[model samples]
Target chain A: MTPPTDPFTAFAPALAGPPRLEPTDVSYVLEDTSLGRMLLAVRDDGRVLTTAFAPDAAHEQHWLERVAQRVSPRVLRHPRPTDAVRRALEDFLAGRARQVAVEPDLALLSDFQRLVLTGLAASVGYGRRTTYAALAQHLGRPRAARAVGTALAGNPLCVTLPCHRVLPAAGGVGGYAGGPAAKEALLALEARSAG
Target chain B: MSLPPFQQLVDDHWRDVARLAHGLAGPVHGDDVAQQAWTQALAAYPRLTHARNLRSWLLTITHRCAMDHHRTRGRTTAHEDPASLAQAPVEPPPQAPDDVLWQRVRALPERQRQAVVLRFVGDLDHRAVAAALATSPGMSRRLVSDALATLRLELTDPEDPR
Candidate 1:
């Protein structure tokens, strides 16, 4: 048996199973807004992580899996953690406020997408619309208008980041994850509030 | 009315559930039993509508997990070698000083033990205990009374003939 010794058996006891991952508690609340049913998710520290529109059963499942993979598997349905953002959204949708006072946790977004979105938010004020080309220019990427549009199309923060305010340079309402009707409605609401 | 956040439920009743687990599942398997209950609770949380008596509901889940732990232990004891089983990790030091008292409670009949744990360790009233045990309020009261009598006799007379 000394001649048939295997090295791996000696370490088998130490190599039992995968290490346990700690649970990160992410809280969320779903509410009906002027646009449609909106699902807002926040980190344990109360920073807004996602603001998706009309999340159907499939969309809800996909969102859960995404958060579980990117964050932790302990995503919980909690209203208090998301209450402040929900109130701000309610006020903005009701035309009582021009903008939601939400600090977005863009940890889930790519660096380039974060750069483009933050640049657009900083340059464009409430009730203001900007062309994708203009936002790219503002970000110092003058020729990246198409790239900027693609980033905005995949915007995870949605209303909280004011992605609705960005439109096509050629004069159409442009594509919105919330749908074309939602984009037009949001623009109209912002126009009324700004006026 | 909308149910309160699942996190809130976990926060408020975690200690109670852990205590009940220790009482029901015993020290060795208590932590595992509590964790299992919370895992089950999280999966079924979204469909919960009412917020009334959430503690009782949680205790019910914990009881179910404790039951499952015992059932699994029963089957494993037959196949598992005694020497290897002795090498299993020891549970953390118990918070309660009365180890013997808890052992006696665990020795009680199943229903009586559950009733006592839910009533004392869980800090739930008789009705809540009833809800957790899926019995009537009257039966829960009788079970607790009977368990207390047995514990009292055993504690006073160390040589109780059973």
Candidate 2:
């Protein structure tokens, strides 16, 4: 039988689920950065769960949903990002930080994607760049460069994993999760830092 | 295969689970029960072998959560004293001024209330209700029937006992 169309029953959908349901160990900070305002979720263990461009609540919600779909559904809120990830992001944007050392939640990635991201993030030097084909070749999947792009496109850890350094083999800057403009800005920042 | 996205699962079933939780945990503690249920459900989701009885699976988890909520909060359960049915609901009297009906519903035995809620409010059939409450289908049917008969007799004539 259909639920009764009573006032209380009608309001059922609007009632938020109770507290204690959300995973509290993972918290997110949405902050303004040189690239754009971004939402970043970090676990208590300090792993960066995901980073996505968010200029407003709608954008934050969009990225949060994707995070839930791909990484964790237990997202919660924190007043600030983890100190290390925060400092690294801030310093990098201001041209003072050397590395954005965030452990991407491998749970958010597939085996191949995890390996590809790990390889690129660890090996790609700052201020320099490499084609997806070259990076794939370096990782010993020489012919899997297109597949590497597919993996990078779904990268959860964004700039902290330094996926912006992976351009297309055609030489023009390739697609980025944070958009082409943010990608270019990051590369420029790294170049100026490198010199 | 991976489970459906957690957000999608919550969107689809929270209401049903909330109603069931509200019935088990009552108003004051129902929200807490619902939240804990979701937490446990999400953690156990990946291990769920199949989705054949997702509603019952969730309700079963919610049932345990509600029970735990009551225990941790030191609330009374019908198991404590079957005779204490007098501790019935006290809210919504002005709204459903004839809401003496809900109060009496609350006055039923604990198992009976659960059965009534699953049958009428949850709209679950005997088998699903049984799976939800971890009882046999036949017993679940009997519990609902007994509760309905009791309600019909006692509610129609508050002074009479059958």
Candidate 3:
């Protein structure tokens, strides 16, 4: 066979190369659930990073940017890292599994948010519900109920962290990142399973 | 076993991939070939169900990407500077430090060159080389031996009888 006259000319198209990506970049996967599309993002160390209920393209973009800002901006979509947590969340939402035994990386949250969310995860169980004021009191911040509400509002781990289990001290289910309908559905599912 | 993060794969094998790229596509195009392979790997990562050897999987992608680079370059005008193309290796030298031996290996027929590079530069076993080259393990072993034998003859002193 004739050796090519030159080696440089044939390979210039890819010479520009693909965009740079780090080996420790964050990765995510999107799963369709009854509530909406859920995005499960994971850190490079293989811990659960953040979960979001993306109702639309814009919602998905917003969560991606949020992760990009808080974590490494080198996020890419790959399912292997988040597969276990994704499966657990799926099972939990479908009432097939009672618990998601995965740990969310709390380092992404503010100190106050981390404190409240950690308290909630430890104190709450499936089919159980807590009032925002009750959770604040549990955290020894009886006067910080509204602050707890704010912290929970920005709950990055969402269902995995059991933020849906927090209701209003008033007589109704409070807001959820996945919307009120999803909140109610999750509560009802847990109630049926628990019963 | 579970697949680790894609980033982990990149971190683990990037240097090997770059070396293989240089061996296959020459120094000038090696980085480009490696980057293109990784970009394609990232795009297709989710669809891959089982990868018994991730290194082999990655090397296969790099080989195909480099080959694609060669084919595409065949169609384009050969206007790039030859002096630059033949410049000193951009990547660090492989285990075999003899530059003349490596150049001769590069000039070998494509299959022999690929088999030898996968065996040495990519540090893949015979089975892994077979997987990357899409050939039988026996064939990969034969190709590697043939390339090595030729290199031994070419590099040894022609007048000195061993």
Candidate 4:
């Protein structure tokens, strides 16, 4: 295809008129997490649509297309995937053992929550496990394990933050916002890849 | 108050959300922005007892959501190559009659292209376009004028009177 000298012209038709809104039977879920509230609209075909935050209460046409994107199938198929969760999945699936270097998309998160999520992202590793108690201790708050768990449960970016990897030191699976089944499935996937 | 009213709102504004989003980023990002707007609007519906215009409300939410997405993406160290902007798919290719004019419009600056889309394609008046872009009416007018001038220069020669 010959590149247009003016890139905007190629899409001018779509731009010329107000864009049309099409209706689809997609089921959407709203999740309020430690980071921020997110909208997860799922099409029947499993395309996942998510935004960083809620719109302001006053504005008409509050939603804009610039914020939306279709997540790749690999990320969407994972049992627990947030915008942050998907990045970890991408790295691990691409054969990276330690995704500590991966960063969470914190657009919706407050600074403290972003810091907690970042710490969780670094502390948790693939196929390995850490207890919420251990995590609290790691962050220098031995008594705040429950708070740490609450933070983990409220994490908007699920797998990317590796909340699933944080198990109970006593051998029970911990709570996951995407549900414990999702947590188990991710652990299994990591194990399979490891072996 | 009931589910159907909420459902009706979704049906009415879904595309507008997507379109506004597309203008902000492109189609791929538009879908995500629309989805987020729907979820946020629905959750806050109970608090909105006096909402006179649902469409505008939804569009506002969509724009905010898109901005949040931009802000979050900005914080990450990742950089998008300028070349990638060229790779975004064009939805409707122009037919022979308007193809040349369409090409000229596309060659305009990003701000001008956005102004044209808001005014012409979005069917938004100057005020609505201004609201969507968060610009003043005068500025919006200037954007449209600049875009039109560029298009006229490219599409029509001074010597030619069609």
Q: Write the per-residue lDDT of candidate 2 for residues B1-162, one digit (tens) a residue.
A: 334445556667888887777767665456667888888887777567766767778887888888677678676644344443344344321234224445556788878888777776666889888877789999999998888777666555445433
True contacts kept of each: 0.06, 0.11, 0.01, 0.04
Q: Per-residue lDDT tens digits of candidate 3, residues A57-107?
A: 777777776776666555676777788887888788778888876767876
Candidate 4 accuracy as lDDT: 0.55
Off by over 4 Å in 3: A1-24, B1-162
* C-alpha lDDT of residue B22 in model 3: 71
Candidate 2 ranges with C-alpha deviation above 4 Å: A1-17, A21-44, A52-87, A94-96, A105-119, A133-148, A169-171, A192-195, B4-15, B35-47, B65-94, B145-162
lDDT at residue B103 of model 4 (Cα atoms) = 46
Which pairs clash in the backbone of model 1? none
For residue B48, give model 1's deviation from the true position in Å.
26
Taking all chains together, the TM-score of candidate 1 against the true structure is 0.53
lDDT (10s digit) by residue, model 1, range A56-174:
85666556556655665457666778889999888888888877888888876789989988887788989999998888888899999998888888787888888999988888898
Each candidate's B-chain TM-score, in sequence, is 0.82, 0.79, 0.84, 0.63
Query: What digit string (tens of lDDT, one per residue) describes model 1 on residues B17-85?
Result: 777775676554566778888878777765576667888888889988988888877723211335533
CAPRI docking class of candidate 1: incorrect
Top candidate on TM-score is 2
lDDT of 4 by residue, A1-195 (tens): 223233333333343222222323333344553333444434435333332234242211122121121221111112233334344344654556555233334543456556566777776666777887888888877898877777766554555566778888778686665556656776877788777
Q: Candidate 3 DockQ category? A: incorrect
Tens digits of per-residue lDDT, candidate 2, A1-195, equal 122223223323224453444445567777777888777777767778777677676767666766655655555566554666777778878887767755667766789988998898779978879999899899999999899999998776778777899888777788986789999999998888899
- For candidate 1, the C-alpha RMSD (Å) to the true structure equals 17.5
Estimate how well candidate 3 is docked, as a DockQ score: 0.04
Error of 3 at A10 (Å): 20
iRMS of candidate 1, Å:
15.3
Q: Write the residue-wise lDDT of candidate 3 on B1-162 in tens digits.
A: 234456557657877777678767776667878989888887776567775787888888998999899898772211244565555344333333344555677677889988987887777889988987888999999999998788777766657635
